[model samples]
Target: MVEFYIGTVDEMLQSTLISAFPIALLIWMMTKQRALPSHIALPITALLVGLIQLFYFHSDGRLLGANIISGVLSVLTPISIVAGAILLNRVLAISGAEAVIGRWLDSISNNKVAQLMIIGWAFAFMLEGASGFGTPAAIAAPMLVGLGFQPIKVAIFALIMNSVPVSFGAVGTPIWFGFEALALSPSDLLEVANQTALINAVAALLIPILALKFVVSGSLIRQNLVFILLSILSCTLPYYALANWNYEFPSLLGGAVGLMMNIFLAKANIGLHTTQNTLNKQTKVPSREVFFALLPLGLLIVILIVTRISPLGIKGLLTSTNAWLGIDIGGSHLGVSQSLVVSLENILSTSVSWSYKTLYVPALIPFVLVVLISIPLLNLSKTQVKEAFFETGQRIQLPLVSLAAALVMVNLMMLGAEQSPIFLIANAFATLTGDSWSLFAALLGALGSFFSGSATVSNLTFGGIQQTIAAQVGLPVNLVLALQSVGAAMGNMVCINNIIAVSAILGIHHKEGFILKKTILPLLVYGGVAALMAIVLS
Candidate 1:
């Protein structure tokens, strides 16, 4: 195998431009006036990257094959999660649970803004913590749409609200696994987590405000300003506080606390005085109906918490391989785990590998579990369950293509090793920014998530680069890394994969560009806030 390097300024400039062309092409094709659907645009963009890797970057077939295979397998994570969410949504609709849940929410508050804050912000925060891989949008968007909000608005708001909780999402995988390569001490990692939380706490003050603009009138927002303020504080305060203690549980616990407080406030009609009369007009929901309607979600949360909260010991058991098999072919080893973990290592005798922790992944345990449980709990009929599964399959067809192409492009770019396009782009930005890298650190993080669609992936890819740049520019490494985490979280708003997944789950097609356009501003605003905090903290 041959490797490429940028040894000269001219070579660096040339390589960077060549590397960026695929991403630039993707953006243009997807966001142009006559936008191409992601299913079409992404494959075309991926083919172009393959050409670039082969001709320009001089990648060999072995590396390309491994990356392509790994990329295709990677699609299973998000697709399965989306499938579970869609199935759950379908089951709810078929069993009339959707209507009951909607009425239950309305019964809490007739004010649409209040409902949006609870579901989109608080509820989404919890879901992100428990199940990060774009699950918040997949689950929340459908619920909001069922509540009569426009699908597009629900999608945008759900994406935006999902940001603050992401760095700590999936039990803080973005921090713990993301920076595993750096081998930072536990205390140092906690510091990074704390700083990331602080930056997000500041952004949280305005994120919900920005998200609300998409759903309600300016006057309606103004009318609920007090409730909005309380709602924002309700989540961020605990979220910020918990990050000081540990990395894993802030988003989960904070969102839980906020959810309870916001529900109480909404029920008590405090700060919702203007809408109290409308709430009064709504009929009360029977406790049993509400319980049955919410049982699946409640079970999901309990299971996720039990499994994810390391102290309970279930996470290790689920993630561990009870048995292992290793096979050698063509001087490469293929190791397979026999239990809950499925791993493929050294693909095609190359260094590339992929792993799927079957039980650790929320798709099987909670999401699918909830879907199965809902049938019996909600007393759903066999015909209804069949329809739900069929609809889920129909909705995911195009998204599967889009996700596969996007990830193949991402893996190809990433597996280019030192000469990877993404690395070159980040290097160029840091070199250009120099002393002001703090201002753009989050943007680099955002770029990683924009391409790869996971904050954890973004951090894994660029966390070391960020640390190097921070030391070279004499910035605090912890603060700069925190910025990376913050940017990655905000990147969720505009992630192409997330847009496609949400669109698929919402039963909307060809609106990826519109959602991207709506989301970019929020991403920018969140990035700006993070940059300013980094500067001030330093």
Candidate 2:
């Protein structure tokens, strides 16, 4: 067993910082050098490190096995969902549907403040719900860029919007990976996660206004108080309500509610606000036509929700499918028991057997919906559709590479390190804080985000550390881990990897430090709130 090592406060701080420094340096060099693309750097690093584990560490088997599993997981589920989402976005983009939708929103209130509230907050959240793993940034950042917003601002806004839906992201991956895999009971896990989610939701309420200030400054906040307040309420209230009752659907349904609320609020305020010269109104296309053009997205949302929730909606189809996969666990060894295969006969078999239902689709709802809706709306020739598919394939290439590389790196580090790196680091932290697990949890949250390059991944990595520490200190594990995860997400706003990626996307080089400086407060605010929650709730 990997036991935690308690050390002096100075020692803990030093070790934690040192353990994190290598990854930090990589982030810095990638941003500074601007030589090789990160897509290439990441995999190269993974391979080099894996080689070290093989030769020097004498831990090649475990490390290599971890890499294989992580690699497979990267492609198997999350990657598929991301690809489907991007394909849907591409369809919308190609069809000029995005412009129409933007124009219609622009029509309701041409005021820049209103537009920011709608787009930065509501629209972004909707994308977060529909697709969580980097899609919000990929989709929303470009739209903001087209809106004449600064790229740095767009990146910042996207990151902020990205936080709210993270717990339920990618069909509940975080909750599944972080909480479910633990020793805790399901009800306890759900309650803890939901409470943590509610806290994050409340923190996210300020995002619209904060993003506006970052994008347009303080004046915009003052100018659109009603709209902004309403927007925040619309987002937080329903999100909290849905999360409490239906944790599975909170982010998904909440995003749609927020989007609709923004639309309604915008339409109601059609002539209420006087425009400032700095914030000009964008032109509008016909709302109904724009809505029609977005039929694919609407269809996607409907189908995903129905297929996931409404059993009767897909009951007959699910009943006839007998496809399933599972690794039969024996002793120390494991192997793949089934491989994924698709056949028309399998598709046909779904209509008559519920036992075979798991094989029926596997979230093909987005793929099917995108193709069906885009064909008519995009007015694409067969050639154009084929090209779109090709483009979609190309677009996912970097993500595919990045995901695989990230998995390999994470797995290697986890398996080959001399100890549970996080545990060693956390024990050092606990000793330093005199068993103040809140501080340790906060620090773990920050550390996990730094390493994993994702809040959700961070949660999965160090959640147990926080829980373990809290238990040792006789504090609440759920609250501490909850805070850890929330702070982890907040930490993403400033993580070197995230900063570099967003900076590059926004065409901002050398100003990453500046962007980090700007975001530092929000990160602190978010973390501070979570830390306070850990303290007060305890």
Candidate 3:
């Protein structure tokens, strides 16, 4: 194990300087360079950070290579989900589901504000649950544009709504993988989820209001106050309830049913009492086409629910690995590896993983199954199916590389860098804040997400540090961890991957910084809400 030093003030400052370079470089490049692809920025940053660790922190090169390899492998599940989301979205569009959804926009509400509630707020939330990986912004922003909303406003709403369900995103990947490294108990997971849900419960109320203000300058908010409250409760009540036992589905199920209920209200013209603009002239779509187009989404929901929640022993079968793959490089999850042991069970292994099962991840099995079934059910043409498959694969290539590199960066800072410069920063914050660290705990968490561009990575990077601080400072451990999760989720708005997703879908690659600027206010709102709540609850 690399020695963790608690050195002098000068040593601490030196450690912080060496460690902070890579992260600061990342932020500067992403915000300053208009055309630098994430795939490029991330990998280079990873390499640079590794070098800095070797020379400055005295980290071992071989171990660093192994950690980077592990980092690349660890992120496969989320990367697959991202690819699946993009493919599913392409398939839906090919089957006219995008158009079908657009047609329903006209039927739901003539008023733009009401329309934003359903699609941008509720429906976007649903996408965040179902496909996340920034897919919500990819889907919702274009849909809003089709409804005649300005492109900028569409992007803003999509990015803002993304904040609500990020911890539960990609079917709770963040919640699961975020704390997986720490190996927290299931009950602790629930407690963490409860705290995150509490902060998001406020978000459930506040997001729609923010959306309305973005749409019409808050004039229509009073007239639609009841509608806002209802929308909030609809997502909040079941969301909190689901967090109690089923951490994966609070956002998934909550967003799914919330979208449906909100759709029902909009179609029934329940929330259209105040505004009467058609938003845009759209043709009435046939119910058959809409249902067929929505087959993938419906199937995705059914598959996730059944596989994840059923007591019929379905998940057990799905989770079982016929073979275990083992890596020979000597490294351990606890710290450094000792040896590469042979697993006589079966032939399933990678450079980073030993005894890993085939399709061991929840996301891989369900999403792949959903895609195969969806191809035939959606009546997707051979050409269209082929197109969607190839297109999604192509689009995700750079993104997957970017994500892996980001994970590599995290692992580099973690595994063997002597607890990292980030840990030192956290320690300093804990010492500085003393009794009031709650105010900045979430900020640190947000920075983790911002730098890594993943809530799971953020959690993996900072969860233990934050936990250590909580224990040292006598802060509420669960609540502080909850703030970490929530802040990471909120960081989705500013994360490079998410920004790329939104901009890629809208065909506005240059507006990344512009989008970042507009979305910061909402991030502050979300961070502020979580911070204040953490202070009060603590």
* TM-score leader: 1
Score candidate 2 by TM-score against the native: 0.77
What is the alpha-carbon lDDT for the whole of candidate 2?
Answer: 0.60
lDDT of 1 by residue, 130-238 (tens): 7688877877788899899998888888888989999999889999999999989999999999999999999998999999999888888888889888988898899
Give lDDT tens digits, candidate 3, residues 425-485. 6666666677677777777888787766778878888888778778777888888889889
For TM-score, candidate 1 versus 3, the one ahead is 1
Q: Which ten residues in a row are the worst by lDDT in model 2?
A: 346-355
Ranking by TM-score: 1, 3, 2
Best candidate, lDDT: 1
Model 1 local distance difference test score: 0.87
What is candidate 2's lDDT per residue for 271-360, written digit by digit as tens? 235654222244546557877866765676555455544345653444333344433232122222122332122112121101112222
TM-score against native, each model: 0.97, 0.77, 0.81
Candidate 1 runs further than 4 Å off: 1-5, 273-277, 322-335
Cα lDDT for residue 108, model 2? Answer: 66
